[model samples]
Target: MNTEKFLELLVEELELENPLTLASNLKELEEWDSMTAMLLIGVVSNEFGKTLSAEDIKELTTVQSLVDKIGAQQFS
Candidate 1:
Protein backbone atom coordinates (compact mmCIF):
# COMPACT_ATOMS: atom_id res chain seq x y z
CA MET A 1 0.00 0.00 0.00
CA ASN A 2 2.61 2.48 -0.94
CA THR A 3 1.35 5.94 -1.92
CA GLU A 4 1.88 5.26 -5.60
CA LYS A 5 -0.11 2.04 -5.50
CA PHE A 6 -2.87 3.66 -3.49
CA LEU A 7 -3.11 6.50 -5.96
CA GLU A 8 -3.28 4.05 -8.84
CA LEU A 9 -6.07 2.12 -7.17
CA LEU A 10 -7.90 5.36 -6.44
CA VAL A 11 -7.64 6.54 -10.02
CA GLU A 12 -9.00 3.23 -11.19
CA GLU A 13 -11.84 3.34 -8.70
CA LEU A 14 -12.78 6.87 -9.65
CA GLU A 15 -12.25 6.21 -13.35
CA LEU A 16 -10.35 9.46 -13.67
CA GLU A 17 -8.38 10.35 -16.78
CA ASN A 18 -6.11 12.75 -14.94
CA PRO A 19 -3.78 11.47 -12.30
CA LEU A 20 -4.70 12.25 -8.74
CA THR A 21 -2.57 14.44 -6.52
CA LEU A 22 -2.70 14.88 -2.79
CA ALA A 23 -4.72 18.02 -3.33
CA SER A 24 -7.40 16.40 -5.45
CA ASN A 25 -10.81 17.15 -4.04
CA LEU A 26 -13.12 14.15 -3.93
CA LYS A 27 -16.28 16.21 -4.33
CA GLU A 28 -14.97 18.04 -7.37
CA LEU A 29 -14.59 14.89 -9.43
CA GLU A 30 -17.35 14.56 -12.04
CA GLU A 31 -17.48 10.84 -11.30
CA TRP A 32 -18.22 11.47 -7.65
CA ASP A 33 -21.69 10.64 -6.42
CA SER A 34 -23.40 8.35 -4.00
CA MET A 35 -22.33 5.44 -6.15
CA THR A 36 -18.72 6.53 -6.08
CA ALA A 37 -18.85 6.89 -2.34
CA MET A 38 -20.18 3.40 -2.01
CA LEU A 39 -17.48 2.14 -4.31
CA LEU A 40 -14.84 3.82 -2.20
CA ILE A 41 -16.26 2.26 0.91
CA GLY A 42 -15.84 -1.14 -0.66
CA VAL A 43 -12.36 -0.31 -1.91
CA VAL A 44 -11.14 0.63 1.53
CA SER A 45 -12.86 -2.27 3.17
CA ASN A 46 -11.91 -5.00 0.76
CA GLU A 47 -8.49 -3.78 -0.29
CA PHE A 48 -7.25 -2.29 2.97
CA GLY A 49 -9.33 -4.19 5.48
CA LYS A 50 -10.59 -0.88 6.79
CA THR A 51 -14.20 0.17 7.10
CA LEU A 52 -15.48 3.60 6.26
CA SER A 53 -18.65 4.80 7.89
CA ALA A 54 -21.08 7.17 6.20
CA GLU A 55 -20.00 9.86 8.62
CA ASP A 56 -16.39 9.22 7.66
CA ILE A 57 -17.20 9.62 3.97
CA LYS A 58 -19.09 12.81 4.70
CA GLU A 59 -16.05 14.22 6.46
CA LEU A 60 -13.62 13.48 3.70
CA THR A 61 -13.13 16.40 1.34
CA THR A 62 -9.84 15.55 -0.30
CA VAL A 63 -7.79 12.61 -1.49
CA GLN A 64 -5.18 13.28 1.16
CA SER A 65 -7.80 12.77 3.82
CA LEU A 66 -8.45 9.28 2.55
CA VAL A 67 -4.77 8.53 2.72
CA ASP A 68 -4.82 9.79 6.26
CA LYS A 69 -7.91 7.78 7.13
CA ILE A 70 -6.42 4.56 5.87
CA GLY A 71 -3.28 5.70 7.70
CA ALA A 72 0.26 6.53 6.75
CA GLN A 73 1.31 3.13 8.08
CA GLN A 74 -0.02 1.53 4.92
CA PHE A 75 2.48 3.58 2.96
CA SER A 76 5.39 2.97 5.29
Candidate 2:
Protein backbone atom coordinates (compact mmCIF):
# COMPACT_ATOMS: atom_id res chain seq x y z
CA MET A 1 0.00 0.00 0.00
CA ASN A 2 1.05 3.58 -0.52
CA THR A 3 2.29 5.57 2.47
CA GLU A 4 -0.54 8.09 2.27
CA LYS A 5 -3.20 5.39 2.34
CA PHE A 6 -1.43 3.66 5.19
CA LEU A 7 -1.29 6.85 7.22
CA GLU A 8 -4.93 7.60 6.48
CA LEU A 9 -5.99 4.13 7.59
CA LEU A 10 -3.85 4.39 10.70
CA VAL A 11 -5.36 7.72 11.61
CA GLU A 12 -8.87 6.42 11.10
CA GLU A 13 -8.29 3.18 12.99
CA LEU A 14 -6.59 4.88 15.91
CA GLU A 15 -9.03 7.79 15.89
CA LEU A 16 -6.31 10.36 15.90
CA GLU A 17 -7.25 14.05 15.76
CA ASN A 18 -4.17 14.99 13.80
CA PRO A 19 -3.17 13.48 10.48
CA LEU A 20 -0.60 10.73 10.83
CA THR A 21 2.85 11.68 9.70
CA LEU A 22 5.85 9.42 9.14
CA ALA A 23 7.48 7.53 11.99
CA SER A 24 4.62 8.22 14.37
CA ASN A 25 4.76 6.11 17.53
CA LEU A 26 1.65 4.04 18.12
CA LYS A 27 2.28 3.83 21.85
CA GLU A 28 2.21 7.60 22.17
CA LEU A 29 -1.49 7.69 21.36
CA GLU A 30 -3.80 7.87 24.38
CA GLU A 31 -6.38 5.92 22.34
CA TRP A 32 -4.03 2.99 21.83
CA ASP A 33 -5.90 0.54 23.95
CA SER A 34 -6.55 -3.19 23.57
CA MET A 35 -9.53 -2.58 21.36
CA THR A 36 -7.48 -0.39 19.07
CA ALA A 37 -4.76 -2.99 19.02
CA MET A 38 -7.27 -5.61 17.90
CA LEU A 39 -8.64 -3.24 15.29
CA LEU A 40 -5.16 -2.61 13.92
CA ILE A 41 -4.42 -6.30 13.73
CA GLY A 42 -7.63 -6.87 11.83
CA VAL A 43 -6.97 -3.98 9.48
CA VAL A 44 -3.46 -5.10 8.64
CA SER A 45 -4.53 -8.66 8.12
CA ASN A 46 -7.40 -7.69 5.92
CA GLU A 47 -5.43 -5.19 3.91
CA PHE A 48 -2.29 -7.25 3.44
CA GLY A 49 -3.75 -10.76 3.59
CA LYS A 50 -1.43 -11.67 6.45
CA THR A 51 -2.39 -13.13 9.77
CA LEU A 52 -1.14 -11.44 12.93
CA SER A 53 -1.68 -12.46 16.49
CA ALA A 54 -2.25 -10.17 19.43
CA GLU A 55 1.27 -10.88 20.62
CA ASP A 56 2.59 -9.82 17.22
CA ILE A 57 0.57 -6.62 17.34
CA LYS A 58 1.85 -5.95 20.86
CA GLU A 59 5.42 -6.29 19.60
CA LEU A 60 4.88 -3.48 17.09
CA THR A 61 5.33 -0.41 19.30
CA THR A 62 5.78 2.13 16.52
CA VAL A 63 4.18 2.98 13.19
CA GLN A 64 7.53 2.36 11.59
CA SER A 65 7.59 -1.16 12.93
CA LEU A 66 4.12 -1.77 11.59
CA VAL A 67 5.16 -0.48 8.18
CA ASP A 68 8.25 -2.67 8.26
CA LYS A 69 6.18 -5.72 9.05
CA ILE A 70 3.84 -4.97 6.18
CA GLY A 71 6.69 -4.35 3.78
CA ALA A 72 8.41 -7.52 4.83
CA GLN A 73 5.28 -9.47 4.16
CA GLN A 74 4.92 -7.81 0.79
CA PHE A 75 8.40 -8.93 -0.19
CA SER A 76 8.00 -12.37 1.25
Candidate 3:
Protein backbone atom coordinates (compact mmCIF):
# COMPACT_ATOMS: atom_id res chain seq x y z
CA MET A 1 0.00 0.00 0.00
CA ASN A 2 1.15 3.50 -0.65
CA THR A 3 2.10 5.36 2.53
CA GLU A 4 -0.52 8.03 1.85
CA LYS A 5 -3.26 5.47 1.40
CA PHE A 6 -2.18 3.62 4.50
CA LEU A 7 -2.18 6.85 6.48
CA GLU A 8 -5.60 7.77 5.14
CA LEU A 9 -6.95 4.43 6.24
CA LEU A 10 -5.22 4.79 9.56
CA VAL A 11 -6.83 8.17 10.13
CA GLU A 12 -10.20 6.78 9.24
CA GLU A 13 -9.82 3.63 11.30
CA LEU A 14 -8.15 5.21 14.28
CA GLU A 15 -9.89 8.58 14.36
CA LEU A 16 -6.68 9.95 15.68
CA GLU A 17 -6.47 13.12 17.76
CA ASN A 18 -3.14 14.17 16.35
CA PRO A 19 -1.15 13.32 13.28
CA LEU A 20 0.04 9.72 13.25
CA THR A 21 3.50 8.37 12.78
CA LEU A 22 5.09 4.93 12.69
CA ALA A 23 5.98 5.53 16.33
CA SER A 24 2.41 6.32 17.39
CA ASN A 25 1.40 4.04 20.24
CA LEU A 26 -2.03 2.55 19.73
CA LYS A 27 -2.54 2.03 23.43
CA GLU A 28 -2.57 5.75 23.91
CA LEU A 29 -5.57 6.28 21.70
CA GLU A 30 -8.94 6.98 23.34
CA GLU A 31 -10.80 5.09 20.60
CA TRP A 32 -8.76 1.94 20.61
CA ASP A 33 -11.51 -0.52 21.25
CA SER A 34 -12.42 -3.97 19.97
CA MET A 35 -14.37 -2.29 17.17
CA THR A 36 -11.26 -0.41 16.13
CA ALA A 37 -9.37 -3.66 16.16
CA MET A 38 -11.94 -5.21 13.87
CA LEU A 39 -11.73 -2.21 11.56
CA LEU A 40 -7.99 -2.67 11.32
CA ILE A 41 -8.42 -6.33 10.54
CA GLY A 42 -10.90 -5.48 7.86
CA VAL A 43 -8.62 -2.83 6.39
CA VAL A 44 -5.70 -5.22 6.08
CA SER A 45 -7.79 -8.04 4.72
CA ASN A 46 -9.67 -5.86 2.31
CA GLU A 47 -6.72 -3.80 1.15
CA PHE A 48 -3.97 -6.40 1.25
CA GLY A 49 -5.92 -9.64 1.09
CA LYS A 50 -4.31 -10.98 4.25
CA THR A 51 -6.10 -12.10 7.35
CA LEU A 52 -4.70 -11.27 10.74
CA SER A 53 -5.20 -13.63 13.67
CA ALA A 54 -5.96 -12.78 17.29
CA GLU A 55 -2.35 -13.37 18.21
CA ASP A 56 -1.29 -11.07 15.43
CA ILE A 57 -3.52 -8.38 16.83
CA LYS A 58 -2.08 -8.78 20.30
CA GLU A 59 1.46 -8.52 19.01
CA LEU A 60 0.88 -5.18 17.35
CA THR A 61 1.95 -2.18 19.47
CA THR A 62 2.66 0.71 17.16
CA VAL A 63 1.94 2.01 13.69
CA GLN A 64 5.28 0.78 12.46
CA SER A 65 4.50 -2.70 13.71
CA LEU A 66 1.29 -2.70 11.69
CA VAL A 67 3.16 -1.67 8.54
CA ASP A 68 5.68 -4.39 9.27
CA LYS A 69 2.97 -6.98 9.87
CA ILE A 70 1.33 -6.12 6.56
CA GLY A 71 4.80 -6.40 4.98
CA ALA A 72 6.47 -4.54 2.14
CA GLN A 73 5.22 -7.12 -0.34
CA GLN A 74 1.68 -5.98 0.34
CA PHE A 75 2.69 -2.46 -0.74
CA SER A 76 3.66 -1.35 -4.20
Candidate 4:
Protein backbone atom coordinates (compact mmCIF):
# COMPACT_ATOMS: atom_id res chain seq x y z
CA MET A 1 0.00 0.00 0.00
CA ASN A 2 1.00 3.59 -0.48
CA THR A 3 1.63 6.05 2.34
CA GLU A 4 -1.63 7.88 1.74
CA LYS A 5 -3.73 4.75 2.14
CA PHE A 6 -1.74 3.68 5.17
CA LEU A 7 -2.31 7.03 6.87
CA GLU A 8 -5.98 6.88 5.95
CA LEU A 9 -6.33 3.46 7.48
CA LEU A 10 -4.68 4.58 10.69
CA VAL A 11 -6.84 7.66 10.93
CA GLU A 12 -9.98 5.64 10.26
CA GLU A 13 -9.09 2.87 12.67
CA LEU A 14 -7.99 5.21 15.41
CA GLU A 15 -10.84 7.60 14.74
CA LEU A 16 -8.39 10.44 14.51
CA GLU A 17 -9.57 13.79 13.23
CA ASN A 18 -6.09 15.23 12.89
CA PRO A 19 -3.79 14.31 10.09
CA LEU A 20 -0.76 12.14 10.68
CA THR A 21 2.51 12.31 8.85
CA LEU A 22 5.33 9.81 8.67
CA ALA A 23 7.17 11.87 11.26
CA SER A 24 4.20 12.12 13.60
CA ASN A 25 5.01 10.96 17.07
CA LEU A 26 2.84 8.02 18.02
CA LYS A 27 3.07 8.73 21.72
CA GLU A 28 1.89 12.28 21.23
CA LEU A 29 -1.43 11.32 19.73
CA GLU A 30 -4.48 11.38 21.98
CA GLU A 31 -5.64 8.16 20.38
CA TRP A 32 -2.36 6.45 21.12
CA ASP A 33 -2.34 4.38 24.26
CA SER A 34 -1.70 0.86 25.42
CA MET A 35 -4.91 -0.35 23.86
CA THR A 36 -4.06 1.36 20.60
CA ALA A 37 -0.65 -0.21 20.68
CA MET A 38 -2.20 -3.63 20.98
CA LEU A 39 -4.60 -2.75 18.19
CA LEU A 40 -1.64 -1.72 16.03
CA ILE A 41 -0.03 -5.10 16.49
CA GLY A 42 -3.12 -6.79 15.19
CA VAL A 43 -3.54 -4.26 12.41
CA VAL A 44 -0.02 -4.78 11.21
CA SER A 45 -0.26 -8.54 11.40
CA ASN A 46 -3.67 -8.80 9.78
CA GLU A 47 -3.24 -6.10 7.20
CA PHE A 48 0.42 -6.39 6.31
CA GLY A 49 1.06 -9.94 7.32
CA LYS A 50 3.89 -8.69 9.53
CA THR A 51 4.35 -9.84 13.07
CA LEU A 52 5.57 -7.30 15.62
CA SER A 53 6.85 -8.34 18.98
CA ALA A 54 6.12 -6.30 22.09
CA GLU A 55 9.71 -5.15 22.12
CA ASP A 56 9.53 -4.13 18.50
CA ILE A 57 6.30 -2.28 19.05
CA LYS A 58 7.77 -0.49 22.01
CA GLU A 59 10.57 0.74 19.84
CA LEU A 60 8.20 2.33 17.43
CA THR A 61 8.06 6.03 18.26
CA THR A 62 6.94 7.43 14.94
CA VAL A 63 4.55 6.50 12.19
CA GLN A 64 7.48 5.83 9.89
CA SER A 65 8.96 3.47 12.41
CA LEU A 66 5.80 1.41 12.53
CA VAL A 67 5.69 1.43 8.77
CA ASP A 68 9.25 0.22 8.77
CA LYS A 69 8.40 -2.55 11.20
CA ILE A 70 5.51 -3.50 8.96
CA GLY A 71 8.17 -3.81 6.24
CA ALA A 72 8.88 -0.66 4.24
CA GLN A 73 8.84 -2.75 1.09
CA GLN A 74 5.20 -3.41 1.76
CA PHE A 75 4.54 0.26 1.02
CA SER A 76 5.24 2.37 -2.01
Candidate 5:
Protein backbone atom coordinates (compact mmCIF):
# COMPACT_ATOMS: atom_id res chain seq x y z
CA MET A 1 0.00 0.00 0.00
CA ASN A 2 0.97 3.62 -0.57
CA THR A 3 2.24 5.75 2.30
CA GLU A 4 -0.83 7.97 2.37
CA LYS A 5 -3.16 5.02 2.63
CA PHE A 6 -1.03 3.47 5.31
CA LEU A 7 -1.07 6.66 7.29
CA GLU A 8 -4.81 6.90 6.90
CA LEU A 9 -5.26 3.42 8.31
CA LEU A 10 -3.00 4.31 11.21
CA VAL A 11 -4.89 7.48 11.94
CA GLU A 12 -8.18 5.66 11.85
CA GLU A 13 -7.03 2.77 13.97
CA LEU A 14 -5.43 5.06 16.51
CA GLU A 15 -8.45 7.36 16.38
CA LEU A 16 -6.40 10.48 16.00
CA GLU A 17 -8.10 13.78 15.37
CA ASN A 18 -5.28 15.08 13.21
CA PRO A 19 -3.68 13.57 10.17
CA LEU A 20 -0.39 11.80 10.68
CA THR A 21 2.24 13.88 9.02
CA LEU A 22 5.85 12.71 8.73
CA ALA A 23 6.87 14.32 12.01
CA SER A 24 4.31 12.53 14.12
CA ASN A 25 5.81 10.30 16.79
CA LEU A 26 3.95 7.12 17.59
CA LYS A 27 4.69 7.29 21.31
CA GLU A 28 3.55 10.88 21.52
CA LEU A 29 0.12 10.23 20.14
CA GLU A 30 -2.66 10.30 22.70
CA GLU A 31 -4.08 7.04 21.39
CA TRP A 32 -0.83 5.13 21.61
CA ASP A 33 -1.88 2.86 24.42
CA SER A 34 -1.57 -0.88 24.63
CA MET A 35 -4.93 -1.45 22.99
CA THR A 36 -4.04 0.71 20.03
CA ALA A 37 -0.70 -0.96 19.72
CA MET A 38 -2.38 -4.33 19.60
CA LEU A 39 -4.82 -3.04 17.03
CA LEU A 40 -1.95 -1.78 14.95
CA ILE A 41 -0.23 -5.12 15.18
CA GLY A 42 -3.37 -6.80 13.91
CA VAL A 43 -3.86 -4.26 11.16
CA VAL A 44 -0.31 -4.67 9.94
CA SER A 45 -0.64 -8.39 9.96
CA ASN A 46 -3.92 -8.28 8.07
CA GLU A 47 -2.77 -5.72 5.53
CA PHE A 48 0.59 -7.32 4.83
CA GLY A 49 -0.39 -10.92 5.40
CA LYS A 50 2.46 -11.23 7.87
CA THR A 51 2.33 -12.24 11.48
CA LEU A 52 3.81 -10.02 14.17
CA SER A 53 4.09 -10.58 17.86
CA ALA A 54 3.16 -8.10 20.53
CA GLU A 55 6.87 -7.85 21.24
CA ASP A 56 7.39 -6.67 17.69
CA ILE A 57 4.81 -3.96 18.12
CA LYS A 58 6.40 -2.85 21.38
CA GLU A 59 9.70 -2.42 19.64
CA LEU A 60 8.34 -0.05 17.03
CA THR A 61 8.85 3.60 17.95
CA THR A 62 7.78 5.36 14.79
CA VAL A 63 5.40 4.95 11.90
CA GLN A 64 8.41 4.70 9.60
CA SER A 65 9.66 1.78 11.64
CA LEU A 66 6.42 -0.10 11.04
CA VAL A 67 6.53 0.75 7.34
CA ASP A 68 10.08 -0.50 7.06
CA LYS A 69 9.08 -3.73 8.76
CA ILE A 70 6.22 -4.21 6.34
CA GLY A 71 8.46 -3.39 3.38
CA ALA A 72 10.96 -5.96 4.56
CA GLN A 73 8.19 -8.51 4.78
CA GLN A 74 7.43 -7.86 1.09
CA PHE A 75 10.90 -9.12 0.25
CA SER A 76 10.75 -12.04 2.65
Candidate 6:
Protein backbone atom coordinates (compact mmCIF):
# COMPACT_ATOMS: atom_id res chain seq x y z
CA MET A 1 0.00 0.00 0.00
CA ASN A 2 0.97 3.61 -0.46
CA THR A 3 1.73 5.93 2.45
CA GLU A 4 -1.49 7.84 2.02
CA LYS A 5 -3.67 4.70 2.25
CA PHE A 6 -1.65 3.40 5.17
CA LEU A 7 -2.19 6.64 7.08
CA GLU A 8 -5.87 6.62 6.24
CA LEU A 9 -6.28 3.04 7.49
CA LEU A 10 -4.30 3.82 10.61
CA VAL A 11 -6.51 6.81 11.39
CA GLU A 12 -9.56 4.62 11.08
CA GLU A 13 -8.16 1.66 12.99
CA LEU A 14 -6.81 3.83 15.78
CA GLU A 15 -10.07 5.74 15.90
CA LEU A 16 -8.26 9.06 15.96
CA GLU A 17 -10.11 12.31 15.47
CA ASN A 18 -7.12 13.79 13.75
CA PRO A 19 -5.46 12.37 10.68
CA LEU A 20 -2.00 10.85 11.06
CA THR A 21 1.07 11.88 9.13
CA LEU A 22 4.43 10.14 8.93
CA ALA A 23 5.74 12.72 11.37
CA SER A 24 2.91 12.18 13.86
CA ASN A 25 4.24 11.27 17.28
CA LEU A 26 2.88 7.94 18.52
CA LYS A 27 3.27 8.97 22.16
CA GLU A 28 1.20 12.09 21.61
CA LEU A 29 -1.73 10.13 20.29
CA GLU A 30 -4.49 9.70 22.85
CA GLU A 31 -5.59 6.46 21.20
CA TRP A 32 -2.16 4.93 21.45
CA ASP A 33 -1.84 2.19 24.08
CA SER A 34 -1.06 -1.49 24.50
CA MET A 35 -4.21 -2.43 22.61
CA THR A 36 -3.32 0.04 19.91
CA ALA A 37 0.15 -1.40 19.65
CA MET A 38 -1.26 -4.89 19.36
CA LEU A 39 -3.61 -3.65 16.70
CA LEU A 40 -0.71 -2.16 14.80
CA ILE A 41 1.24 -5.38 15.03
CA GLY A 42 -1.67 -7.23 13.59
CA VAL A 43 -2.10 -4.69 10.82
CA VAL A 44 1.54 -4.95 9.83
CA SER A 45 1.46 -8.74 9.88
CA ASN A 46 -1.76 -9.05 7.95
CA GLU A 47 -1.36 -6.18 5.54
CA PHE A 48 2.38 -5.96 5.04
CA GLY A 49 3.35 -9.56 5.78
CA LYS A 50 5.68 -8.52 8.57
CA THR A 51 6.02 -9.30 12.25
CA LEU A 52 6.74 -6.81 15.00
CA SER A 53 7.71 -7.84 18.48
CA ALA A 54 6.52 -6.01 21.59
CA GLU A 55 10.02 -4.60 21.90
CA ASP A 56 9.82 -3.29 18.39
CA ILE A 57 6.44 -1.79 19.16
CA LYS A 58 7.87 -0.06 22.25
CA GLU A 59 10.59 1.51 20.17
CA LEU A 60 8.12 2.98 17.74
CA THR A 61 7.95 6.62 18.75
CA THR A 62 6.33 7.94 15.62
CA VAL A 63 4.19 6.80 12.74
CA GLN A 64 7.25 6.91 10.54
CA SER A 65 8.98 4.46 12.86
CA LEU A 66 6.17 1.97 12.45
CA VAL A 67 6.17 2.58 8.75
CA ASP A 68 9.87 1.86 8.71
CA LYS A 69 9.31 -1.38 10.61
CA ILE A 70 6.67 -2.38 8.11
CA GLY A 71 9.25 -1.37 5.54
CA ALA A 72 9.67 1.84 3.57
CA GLN A 73 9.72 -0.33 0.45
CA GLN A 74 6.29 -1.68 1.35
CA PHE A 75 4.90 1.72 0.52
CA SER A 76 4.84 3.33 -2.86
Top model by lDDT, which number?
Answer: 1
TM-score of 4: 0.91
State the lDDT of candidate 3 residue by residue for 1-76, as single tens digits: 6776787788876676667777888767788888888888998898888899988999999988888998966666
Error of 6 at 21 (Å): 0.5
Greater-TM-score candidate between 3 and 6:
6
Candidate 2 structure quality by residue, lDDT tens digits, 1-76? 6777788987887687877766777878877788888888888888888778877787887777887877854532
**Deviation from native of the Cα of residue 54 in model 4, angstroms:** 1.2
What lDDT does candidate 3 reach at residue 33? 85
Q: What RMSD does model 6 have?
A: 0.9
Model 1 residue runs over 4 Å out of place are none
Q: Which pairs of residues clash in candidate 5, taking residues 3 or more apart in a chain or in different chains? A: none
lDDT of 6 at 41: 84
Ranking by lDDT: 1, 6, 4, 3, 2, 5
Native-vs-model 5 lDDT?
Answer: 0.77
TM-score for candidate 5, please give it: 0.82
In terms of lDDT, the poorest run of 10 residues in model 6 is 40-49
lDDT: the better of candidates 1 and 3: 1
| lDDT (0 to 1) per candidate | 0.89, 0.78, 0.82, 0.87, 0.77, 0.88
In model 2, how many backbone clashes occur? 0
* Candidate 2 minimal-lDDT segment of 10 residues: 67-76
Worst 10 residues of 4 by lDDT: 37-46
lDDT (Cα) of model 2:
0.78
lDDT of model 5 at residue 56? 77
> What is the Cα-based TM-score of model 1?
0.92
RMSD of each: 1.0, 2.5, 1.5, 1.0, 2.8, 0.9
